[model samples]
Target: MEDNSRSKNRREFIQSGMRLSLALALGSVSGLALSKVVKDEYVWQIDPFECTQCGRCATECVMTPSAVKCVHAYDLCGYCDLCGGYFKPDANQLSTAAENQLCPTAAIERRFIEEPYFEYIINEDLCIGCAKCVEGCTAFGNGSLHLQIIHDICLNCNECAIARVCPSNAIKRVKAENSYLIKGDFSKEQES
Candidate 1:
């Protein structure tokens, strides 16, 4: 009888140990799976297509110089001797005169890369996001010189101020890795 009782207790102990081990193993597996699922849900992406070119990106941004700035697309650019974005539409002619330039701050620097090929560079410090240059580019030149949100100046807020006031419903939060410079469908080839 005593031997039987001892054997019964030992068996019970082994069974309990096995159950505990199985539970621990299952718990760990589930925990890992849950973590993976959560990680998969968290991905970053920005939709440059949605940007409305609203001026808020210039002021509401936390940075001194708003992260949003105009970028020149040279590939789609006509490189015209007279850049519409640089020169005022009413200007007498395509001259380097400050009065004739559309840019309020003279941020667009025009250099003669070659005949009929002018390279337009933006001085970011002077850019005000007035969209004057973008408007000119879109109207007469290639749809280059679009506005982009610069990450370095962006606060990366949970809710972007520019996103709220955007008339075209542009401005989307994307992952940090894929944050900016997405020229989707703009067709402007990157300049070398």
Candidate 2:
């Protein structure tokens, strides 16, 4: 009878240990799965259409020199002699000279591709997110020049500083694949 009792206790103990081990394994697997699901659901994105050009993206961001910068849509652009993006609206006339240019750093390079056709290029390193150029471009031209967040420079913080202060609610989290160079109009397809 004592032997039978001892064997029964031993079986119970073994079964209890096995149950505990299985529970722990299952808990670990569930935790990993939950984390992956959360990670896959979140991403960062900026909307160009609703942006207010507040200039907060330039200064408020945690990254040094900020991830926000201006991008030019060459296809939508007319490449005219008078580029609204490069010149101040109040300027007496459009000219390549430094004083007339809207960009504080003169970061935009204007090259003549042909008669009445000019190429506008942004020097990303020098841009300060002032939006002066973008504002100029959008006002009088084809709305080609616009602000974009450079992912390499972005901190990709849990909550973006720019999004917090954006009055137009233009910045939001989106999937990583569809992130950059968001052109405002759907009619204009991605040009080669």
Candidate 3:
């Protein structure tokens, strides 16, 4: 009986130890899975204010045409017929001619809003992320033209090639819900 009691106690102790080990393993696996779910909420982005528009976005992105595209802040735009962002600096006339356009792809489409005012829109498919329009607008216009990451086309690489080579460190991870850093929004923040 004494031997049998000792054997039972040993069996119980082994079972208890196994149970504790299993619980710990399960808890650790759960924690790791939860962390991954939390991480999925964020995506890579470009901070417009920090971006120098060195034209690296056009060349350094892993994607062929690049996931970076030009974004226009119409609210902050002056709607000028002679848009600095839309027309070449040496444009022969402020007309809607392909030759007079600053963008190599002719991505910018101008629609007459009224006399001396035209609404400019960027065709993302045609944009090459060259930043020429952005440079021209910021230098000579209301600074509405800017670059932004198009998440739809982005591969969301673990280590972004463009971010690594970015001269201004403009690229960063941002929450998926509020990914875009609009030019108008940045201007408002600077004022405050």
Candidate 4:
């Protein structure tokens, strides 16, 4: 009878241990799943490293004005008075005249910082994401002006229309924190 009682207790103890193990295993899986969900949060962005300065970003976006906009990495900028992103190739003068402007929309505004240093500002309201400035910047100056998806203006479509037709295959869903892939000193630029 004592042996029977001991055996019964042993069975109960084993069962309790198994139950606790099962619970722990289930809890671990749940925790892992939750972490994955949080880590996988993604957003649509243009990979400037892969972008070829194609004109499609302007026309292919579902949004009328398009979410893609030229962003200047000031740290990467040469601050040249004859900024390639701001001025046309054959521009006779280094002035703010419409004829001298590379951007058709006049979205890029040049501000005089010093004698030779100038600041280029993108007027988001007027920008059409045409890549004219981007192309010019890449060809003539340090590639400070690159295209990026303006999250505030983006529709965040389940499947981005621009991504489908992207010739360089530069547009895609990226983890939220890794979205803006700029060419140079990207981490430094993000700190500010």
Better of 2 and 4 by lDDT: 4
Worst 10 residues of 4 by lDDT: 181-190
Instruction: Tell me the tens digit of each residue's lDDT in model 4 across 66-106.
Output: 89999888878999998888988899899998999989999
Cα lDDT of model 1 by residue, 1-192, tens digit = 999999999999999999999999999999998786633222222244555455566676656666677877566677888787899999987778898999888999989888778889999889876778877877787767778776656666667766777777677654555455546333343442
Q: Per model, state how many residue pairs clash.
A: 5, 1, 0, 0
- Put down candidate 2 lDDT per residue, 1-192, tens digits, no spaces: 999999999999999999999999999999998787744444556677777777787887787777888987677888878888888777776778898898999999999888878899999999877788878877888888888888878878999988988888888887776667467443354442
Off by over 4 Å in 4: 1-39, 187-192
Please give the distance, in angstroms, between residue 44's alpha carbon in candidate 4 and its true position after superposition. 0.9
How far off is residue 110 in model 4, in Å?
0.7
lDDT of 3 by residue, 1-192 (tens): 999999999999999999999999999999998787765467889888898879999999889899999999888899988888999999999888899999999999999878878999999999999999998898899888999999999998988899999988999988888878888876787799
Model 1, residue pairs in steric clash: 44-175, 45-174, 45-175, 50-170, 67-150
TM value for model 1: 0.68
Q: Judge candidate 4 against the unseen true structure and give its global Cα lDDT, from 0 to 1.
A: 0.88
Top TM-score hit: 3
CA deviation > 4 Å runs, candidate 3 = 1-40, 186-192
List candidate 2 stretches off by more than 4 Å. Answer: 1-42, 184-192
Ranking by lDDT: 3, 4, 2, 1
Which scores greater on lDDT, model 1 or model 4?
Answer: 4
User: What TM-score would candidate 3 get against the native?
Assistant: 0.78
User: What local distance difference test score does each model get?
Assistant: 0.72, 0.81, 0.90, 0.88
